[model samples]
Target: MQDFLLHGILAISAIHMAHCNPDKREKYATISARHQNIALSQFSPGLTEIGENNADAYVLHAICIFLVNTYSIANPQGPITSRDVAQSFILLQGIRSILALPFAHRYIFNGPLARWLYQGSVEPAVGGNYSSKIDDLLNLTRSMAPSDDTLTCQSALEGLKHTFAAVSTPQHRKGLVWRWAVSLPQSFLELMSQNHPMALVILMYYAALVYAFERNMWYLTGWGSNVASALDKAIQEPWREWIQWPLRCIREGVDIRQVEPLKPVEGNPRTQLPTINFNLGLFKPSEPPP
Candidate 1:
């Protein structure tokens, strides 16, 4: 299973590179197809193993499938479709479900894979006064979703901080966004469902972080930009002001931290943020699927 995962990663990397260099697309596409087939074929057995008591391996399998799905939509040959976008969300949900398993945290946190998924068990110091920025966002969330459970809001804030630390660091890593995505408490998702302005705003900043490091990898190309745009469009007035900085960062191709902080709207009363279709495909490729 590990070997299959490794091959899938390599094949995806090759596909990204091939996408960048059009000359190799045909050859790498064939190779990628083979890898995808092999990975998919093994997926059932690997899943069965986890179901049959080898539960410790669940994370590994989830990560493997996650990589496969990521590359599939990122393939340069065509634009991602709504179906692809839906599949991406399903894949992420599967990974999140595994991570949420009671016994899974011990293995995920202690195992070597943790290094790839998280910076460490202890929170790393983020550069600048970012904590304040995070706090502001959290406070906004509280104001926006007054009914949201306090504990869940706090967990979401911590997850945001963790993602900020990972992205703000000089070193770029894949899966940081995924880690943050899975770590978000259910309450956070509830906020998103309600189109909480603060929730969308935080996601915009996260998208900016993803955009900042996009140049380092082929798979990350366009992801941040798409997410930022979608969120910007989905959000409405007063709340929209909160995301201007991140949206500007996306448009200007600058780090979001370099942008000025959002000024608080002094007289604004808490109002329900208008919801949009806001599906997983909002960040998926805009072009037709291959």
Candidate 2:
């Protein structure tokens, strides 16, 4: 089983590399041309086409399929192997990289430009009903996130601090959860209403990836194996349908089930923080004390 998993990963990796190597050049050209034509301020073009068409998704999907195949070959309806779990981790990593690129490299992913594009499109119309709230939620989570640029993240942190201050009351926190819980399914339905199946797929897959990462990170950090086991148990559809749904019953706010659980991950610094450079530049004396 392990041999099968290893061979499958190698084959998938080789194929994805060969496939994407040629397309990467073309993809870059297409993306750059699209950006050049778009003014980027008043209007933006979405990943609507690009996201669906990206090589990353194809590569990740291929690897995932291979992983599942390997699992089935080995277990044939029984226990999932470590290889299977590891492959899931790899898939999550790929997805995270794909998602983070939009924010990490604005020149490439261009959040503002994408949002502008969404706004300009007949699809999301400027200040449209769903656009504002969805954008707000995404932006809020992204802003609270820690990232490579200290200044950029600091600004976001400040905004979050202020936002949290304004809405920090226990009641408000509960209300926020309640509101999100109520809004989640509605948002899911809204996406469906637009015939946007990708949105639902992306949302659900992203959520699952988030849960998996949280579990593995905790396990790696020396959290008792029980948490990891609980996570594994949580992913099953039956468990997700029953226990997971009720997990959000507390306080009836923000539907904790809908949001990814944040876990404190302890690991190699290099792995965790690839983009950050810790060196501080030398300080110069101010014009001989003026």
Note the Cα lDDT for every prediction shown.
Answer: 0.57, 0.29
Model 2 lDDT per residue over 94-120, tens place? 333344444333443443324311111
* Top TM-score model: 1
Where does candidate 2 stray beyond 4 Å?
Answer: 1-76, 81-83, 98-290
Per-prediction backbone clash count: 1, 5
- Model 1, span 1-290: residue lDDT tens: 46556565665665665566667666766776676566556555555344423443555655555654554543323433333333454555666555545555556666666676545543565555455667776776566545645556667677878776666555646556565665655456666656666666776767766776677766656667665555766788887776766676667666654554444222211111111111232121121212
Name the candidate that leads on lDDT.
1
Instruction: Kindly state the number of residue pairs that clash in model 2.
Output: 5
Q: Candidate 1: lDDT over CA atoms? A: 0.57
In model 1, where do residues sit more than 4 Å from their true spots? 1-7, 10-14, 23-34, 51-61, 71-114, 117-119, 123-130, 149-154, 166-177, 190-197, 258-290
TM-score of each: 0.65, 0.20
